[model samples]
Target chain A: MRLPYLLAGLSVAAVYLVLLHVGEGRQREAEEHAKQGHVTASYAQLGKAYALYHEGHWPLLDTRNRHFAYDLGIVPKGYAIKQEMEKDHAPQAVLFGKLGRHAALSLVPLVDFRNYFYLGFAVTTEEEGLALAKALRSGAALDRDIKVAQGTGTLGSSTLYRLHDDIVETLVMDGVLARQDLTLPGRIPVIVERPRDGYAWVVFLDMHVEHLRYPGPFPLTSKFVDTLESDAL
Target chain B: MLHERYDWLDQARGFVVLLLIVSMPTSEYAGDLLTGDPVLGPPMLNHGYEYFDGDPAITTFIDSGQALFLLVMGFVGYTAFTSRLRKRGKGAAFWYCARRVGVLYALASIDCVLLELATSGKPKWGDFFYNGTFAMIALGTLCAFLSIVVIPNADRRMLFSVGLIMLHSLLYAFPFFDHHTWYDNILALPKFPFGTLGMCAMAIAGSSFGQWHAMDPDNPRTGFRKRIVPVSTAAFVAAYCMDWVQPAQHHDSNAAMLLQAMYIGGFMLMIFFAFGEVGFRFPLLSSLGRNLLLMFALGGLFIGIYLDCFPKEFLLQSPYLALLLGGLAPIVILSCVAVFLDRRGIMVRA
Candidate 1:
């Protein structure tokens, strides 16, 4: 509003825009460093080892389940994918590419519309993830949500808590919810198994549902959780 | 802990922190998008997340989120620095600001180290370059730079701020420089010339506004706020059009940048007036906003610990579930914490 302020604001804004544009000008790598992982992998507190793919084990790929990244693999296809790849933080893997094509070809169901039942899987240890995978392979129920209950207190030198719950938090969601007893739809369950051997598995087999057509039993289900579990590291 | 004098600033500050915190998946929520019904739901997109996937457009949302914080940093920094400069003279003001910036730099570095350890198990130098904390470093650097260079005369400093923007345009004209140095000098210089310079531009822009406001903090220039709105609105429309035509993050024209700044200015003024007229109400948000810096640290810790202990997939089954359960839940806890801290007379003064 003040002429000086206006001029100055415009100038500063100009500098920022140019610098950003120029930084991306050559398009360095067109890759995101956020680490590739199953949707659930990004949820819990897994340290640096928390990504979907770690030590040759891919969270979704190893089991019957797979994560189709919302913007990463799906949505942007072919040329669009190639051009817009720079925006995302993860680089697409070959397997993700194949899944991208499959999703693109599918008809009748809009992938964007059914984002409700997306389940996530995470664990404290890679070994635990493998063990959970083993358990799922032996068949961990997909139609029911899993619960370890928050405030379970130190289970095995570590805390046994709610894997997930309502409330928008920053960074990590503090698990003390439902008065230490977390309950959700059984099928979309994440069991943050008690801290075992200095490692507690925080499994996020969860989904965020906004608008739904059917009232109960939110429709998404996968055979992957039933057959896949993590392999011992 | 709203200071009677600058409650609006405190409110806006907290809101910026809140907006940033809310957008990403938090310690509890993970911001996961899930379907309530598991009935043969479509598969998770392999690569993941489109900007348009949600009701609110993610890209524009992110863009708008950034708009206010940048302005706030400048407004707060300039006004505070000017007062100090008046009291202590140039030398004292310069060192005082530098010391404060040094503290910010130190904290920002710690955030980087913490993030790396949370994600990778070890702290590497690359983390300094990689994480968003670099922005903080840049902000601190800009504060020092502006204190010495632009804190002399309000009118001259205001004009100087405008000059920085024009210089930015000139740089774009050459367009041959590369920013790889931004990555290279991460450890030695931290946020050096380019990154610090760009941030400096934005903060100084805020300073110009602050300079104008300092003339009458209690009674801000009504005409200035009013005049900027339409100009900003029109500029925003123009920027949008430019974006539509060019549409490259890396190739936006200077004209586009000009309009975008105008738009952001307009948006900021609107927010100030809107909040002032409506009167602040959201206690949790205000609390979080008030204790913004401390919470930024605390919140980052919460995220780091959870992220390390749990993977993202461990978040609620879907984002919808996240919204209902994960989203609003933590605000209450955090706000209580703020109130508790405020009562104890504890706060991050910087």
Candidate 2:
């Protein structure tokens, strides 16, 4: 009996080690494929790496970003969002919203990990952005602690507002029919109005308030918003 | 009467069932109570802190409970299969097991459909095979049965399960499968809860222990103490070291899978000795355990009824009251139903 049990344990241990080696080899192969500019092949290898390691970071994001029309830095490597995409002219996915639909274009980590943060933005024309911002500031059932910061400051050159904790207010999404009934909890709203080459642009940033304080400052500023406005193709 | 000798198994099952129902049903309501700042308490839906979104505590609880449930299934199922094979014939046993898989899938479908009807007022037929607990259990049961048939020897089967988990890990490392979509469900064949391989491995591994227990039915306590306890402990320690090195979240990682299965194996042993051997009967738990499937359905029904009837506003007004009522209502009701059924010696299997 003891002999059988011992043998079984030993065999399991051996197999586990061998599988780990195989997983590591796959990871190395994925890197080699990536370096050789085998984009599709690299993606396939990285997909295998992801399946093997589960939580291990692989560079599948380059292809994912290209597929989703996301900026390279928008979603960090080693993190992924749910792959469900909204059927719209522009690429959009909900980050922590119910049933894969939300009013904001947010970059929130799908899975929780170290250095978790959220960045949501809705781009519009200057006239539309201003009118929308005005309506949001004067929205019905506003919380008392909510204060919308006017103009640029240490916070940034954009208009920023922090809603009180646990507060839920419905916001109207102009031109977007699907998100008309968008309600967010403890939303931190910001607007960056910038005049670019041909059109004036307004970028609305709707962030989760609690996340803003704990994870520290995001590597974002009015300059970045201006870059978005300038770089829009 | 046939199951009376291993009442500990029932008790362990009951305990896990209680844990699963309490944690799962009240998650949304508990979120409202704990995070009491949301306006429009009742009828308004406030998203709760979802599992696997970085909450270590909830993730550990869910993972362990889920693995343990399947482990119990494997243990109990092996005994049922072998006994039928001996008494009736191989064909009868196979069909018996096949019917069980079908019944469990049917239960899972009904549960999903009803819950969807209650919550969203629209039911998708695809939800019948969603990656819910029962669907996974059904698939795991199928795999375990097949493994048992293929690898007749107990030790080889145990080794086979370990290989199966590694295979699952290897498959999962690939990114073809999408979780939470219809494709993620076990019915999609080669996705999580089925294709993921861990759950099936758990069931097969559990059956090996069942083999051991059946070998010496008269002296099960001694056999369990001498063999199962130490082996599970060593596996637990080994799995822990693997997890320490890898630190993967939830049950996705190989380390987490092994750790959870062994951890629950040890927990079942503890429950067996503490409650089963000592003649210290916990009626509520054992009652829920005896008719696990029925209780599971009843628990889901009661929870659906509670959520549908009393929305967050009514519940969240008094958070403590809501927590107590929301968490305990299904548990208490199911225990009563289980006990009532058990008292009449009604054991509803499938």
Candidate 3:
């Protein structure tokens, strides 16, 4: 009896490995195409990767129950509306005692991601955002105490601010910071300054590269806003 | 014959629960207190455990005490379930298991709510399922009930366990959605690597071993050595091999559950063979083993209250003092409760 069960398990495991290898192969191809600037091909490969690897809707049993779309994928209208509302206001100051108890500090109400690149949003007044951005840009030249390299490329409507700090560098070196996705390559810190709708929204990129470099093809644009606004409707 | 209590099993469970009780406070407070100090931190905190994610190197069976508990429960719980089924019939057995699940669920919910209130001054309804150990146990028990009702045979239960784990392994391969925020990984929210299934698999697989012991109650140790030992060893090796293909993180993958179940099985086997008599003499172990759910729930509640009242800042002032008050104090208090309950012939099963 054990022998038969073992044989069956081995068979299933072999199939699982084959599927895994094929899925991973497609995923790698997708990444390669993405790097090569083949957006359509990359996306096509990604879809194939999903079909092979993901047991979407549990097709094996034709179970009516659907595999849950992860929280990051589904952007509910209410949450988007909340993000829009929060965009006009500063982040609610959490009490010191409540800091480590919950994930409130790490919770970004609005986010968008494509491949390895992630864009996170925080609410700040327009004046504060501009003043801070301006101060950072100016402070790079004057302030020897801090180092900030302004990136030449633009991230949608925002100006890319590449921050170089010893603490972050040490953290990256020591591998102290955890990546959002385990599959992502190491860790790096980058910040973007986006001023929009009478608010200086501090747009943060969720990149986990080895070193700070301009992430390729910033996709969060007017379309992102349009999508959110329309979804809110 | 199957209804007979196993002191060694209870002692092993007591040991696991003790680890759970200590590790929680130690990780929460001591990690912060002694993190950067050159002399006090490194090796002392090196073996310290957590309910980890993603990182394969740090993710071990040792990290998840919850998995250990489930493994033990898988044995005794299944044996007890079978005993009840034989004596009282299906309805009684199902009711017995259902009531246990309900109690566990209630305790887990209360623990989450109390901790939330302690920290944030308000209870977040969403966080009620955040307590991983309790949630896993409750759900695992429910799954065990279902599995027993549907596939009671030990051989089939083992097959079901293997199949579920295989499915679980495949499920994680396509986590296409980027978890960019902390909320994305929240247990309350729908996410990949639903650990309840993993726990269920662990319980079912565990019950297979329990069945072996039951088959030869007169010579259970011989049966354990002949059957459970080799099988567990093979499963452990298999799980380790599969883990290389995909890193096994606790509650994140079914492979991790298999690894942990084997790990705990091996540990319990060690206790059974060598220190079986030692465990039999330990009344506190017996008490803790019997009142597993009650102790765990109360321990968690006490930890929450202690953290809230004392706070980390106060604890940090004198790290050694904090270690004593924050860590040892709760264990001592819990031991007293366990002992008192034991002496009074009280056993809170759920």
**DockQ comparisons of all candidates to the true complex:** 0.02, 0.07, 0.08
Q: Is candidate 2 or candidate 3 better by lDDT?
A: 2
TM-score, one value per model? 0.49, 0.58, 0.61
Ordering by DockQ: 3, 2, 1
* Candidate 2 lDDT by residue in tens digits, A36-132: 2222222223233432453322222122212211225433333234454555534433445442244334343332211111112221233223322
Best by the TM-score measure: 3
RMSD of 3: 17.3
**How well is each residue in B8-75 modelled by candidate 1, as lDDT tens digits?**
66666777676655544432322333222212111221111231232112233334333345556666
**Best of the candidates, DockQ:** 3
Assess candidate 2 and give its lDDT.
Answer: 0.53
Model 3 stretches astray by more than 4 angstroms = A1-10, A23-233, B30-54, B113-132, B176-190, B251-254, B277-281, B307-323
DockQ of 1: 0.02
Model 2 spans with C-alpha error above 4 angstroms: A1-233, B1-5, B30-52, B55-58, B112-130, B173-196, B245-255
- Candidates 1 and 2: which is better by DockQ? 2
Q: For candidate 1 chain B, which ten residues in a row score worst on lDDT?
A: B39-48
CAPRI quality level assigned to candidate 3 from its DockQ score: incorrect
- Candidate 1, lDDT over the whole model: 0.43
lDDT of 3 by residue, B197-233 (tens): 6777887777777786676777767657776777777
Provide a comma-separated list of chain B TM-scores, one per candidate.
0.69, 0.81, 0.83
